[model samples]
Target: MKKVVLTTSLLAIAAAAQAQSSVTLYGRIDNGIQYENGSPQGHKIAAESGDWGCSWFGMQGSEDIGGGTAVIFQLEGQLNTQNGTSSGALFGRHATVGLTNENYGTFKLGNLGAGELQQDSWALDPQLMQRYAISTLTHGRNWPGIANGFEYTSPKWFGLTLKGQYDLSNNTNWNSGVLPAGQGRSDAIEAIYATGPLEVRVIYDELRSTQGNFNNLYAASRSIMGGGTYTLGPVKLWAGYQHLNAPQASDASVFGTDAVSAANLPGGVSAPTSADHEWGGAAWQVTPAATITGAVYHTNVNHGNGNATMYTLAATYNLSKRTFLYTEAAYLHNSSTSNIDLGNDSWGPNNYNGANNTTSGAGANNPDYGHSMTGVFAGIMTAF
Candidate 1:
């Protein structure tokens, strides 16, 4: 009996030690019903969800290493609640590992969302309606692919924090056939400030891609964005501005050339030309469980020959902590010389193509397009 008691005690201690090396499993499940019109010249209604927050499962853990330092890691992936399929490439959202010290800062590595994403994430609009989530609009712009990278986040100082990230291209060439030397390299930098009821951020990103064609046409794109938010009583006001410039081949070597040519191909015979976008919104909490949000976004594209403007509005409502309903409507008023299009050939409909006049559809060949998109979504979300 003595020996058995001693063995049981040892096992207990081992279990406790293991528990100290904490690991947690967490996830959110969201789904709803949706209706869309003016999409590819059709009207449709279907079961939809993931507007407020994508359904996902994640595992995170931290191990104390003594000396006031710890090792941490997280792995997360998105899911499609309707079809029960993976959202995208495995581990598409986040896969990172790093270390933290009580007095120092934290450093992480892998494919992770940018600091700009955090700025957008804090918006109170999504709490009321998923349609008001800025993430739904920015999509690719928010999480530019960095391949392999590292990020550092400083400990908060007087309610202010600093973060920086660097991504290496592994020296891979994306323009072997398009451009003689190619420019398939990229980099990014960002800064942020937060205090009390105010928050602000600025970010700059550049990407160089080589065209796989004769004349070795190389494309280099750059974007700069700055924004801020202020809170007063039950009202929160937000504003932001972004500038994007992409110059492509004089001819049809790049993918965006079709739209460029269709628009009369301005900007001195280059691709993409230039685009400036400005947006702002306000969120009002009408009650504890319900909020009202409204935002307006405008984009001006200059391709030398012509220009165009696009505007959007979105709102949402939270029925409960784990459930919400939302709606979004957008209008693009193109000038006579402006050629605007829409489709979901890439990430999704949110990308918006000007030349085709097609919007992002739910699935491939879903035929949802043209002029405007009005969608109403109602869904429930549970977190664990």
Candidate 2:
């Protein structure tokens, strides 16, 4: 009898303990087909994944530690649903553990979303900087998440919230002079205001590295961005601007507007004089189940590279609360001396950069620079 009573008591305690914490599993799967023209390799058509937002699977949970405090954790990873592969990181997208307090705010450690992505770019852009048309057209392409990161998010006060992030180069004492991961460190600070129908944001981010695994010797990149949104009637309007500067460094080349990966500038070259970007867009909720959005993006690259512009129109139809169908078409214009992705980052087969260059086609991957590219894709997405 005593054993039975003890068992019942322990089971009750277990149930109570479980009630203090909860873990939920969630994810989104997105896939689509795309068509493009004016790539280095000419025209193409194929299926694509993550063209909207990267597909992902993740779990988040929190345990109440005590009064007004909780311990929180999240594990999220990218999924290539079409290829059945990972986004290359075990938890490449997000891997974090943190503490949250109702009044104190939240602090997190480990890999997390970068500043431009979490703080600035997403807030100002209508597309949330996805792999779509506007994303390619904007200078936010440099936005990225980082490893060895720390982030702080402050609670809102008077409609204002502040966030900061630091990425440790993880070098031994931030080793200098062309060391692996010589970027030393990166940082960003952002402020956001939200109330009723108005939202505003300001952000500053920078990167410093020498041996940043780029074709040219690494230097530093800095950016300042500001933007806002207003809600009026059934239409939501957004506008924003970004400026980027990459100066030439001793014994190193300047960074390009597109990318500096081992693939972009194999032999390395001088960076451009400067780059400027501007954009504006609006979303109209035409019905309870549908929305139409359009945006125009432009960029000017100095050093005689000329100008690039992109126009995109997209629509979404909701089949249910958790599922939606979307279609979008984009037109990108590249001056004879300038080549920018019409699909944003890289659409089409061949990839290109700068003004009027061509490269081998990667089947259906990014398009080369120096050519105008146009593309359209329709896809379905679901969240669970």
Clashes of each: 26, 11
Model 1 Cα lDDT, one tens digit per residue, 1-384: 999999999999899779668999988888877666544546677786575556888898998888888899888878998898987656766788999986798988876632323334344232322443333333234434444667887888877666776655454453322111212445566667888899887776665554322221112456677888899999889888777665553334344334432343323423345567677788778877666666765555554423434344555566666555655554444444433332112222122333333422323222222244445556667778
Candidate 2 regions exceeding 4 Å error are 113-120, 138-142, 173-184, 211-220, 249-270, 343-370
Return the TM-score for each candidate structure.
Answer: 0.77, 0.86
Give lDDT for model 1: 0.55
Give the least accurate 10-residue stretch of model 1, judged by summed lDDT. Answer: 174-183
Model 1 TM-score on a 0 to 1 scale: 0.77
lDDT of 2 by residue, 114-204 (tens): 3323335776888666555434753334454556778889999999999888777776655222321223466789899999999998888
Q: What local distance difference test score does each model get?
A: 0.55, 0.68
Q: Which ten residues in a row have the lowest lDDT in candidate 2?
A: 346-355
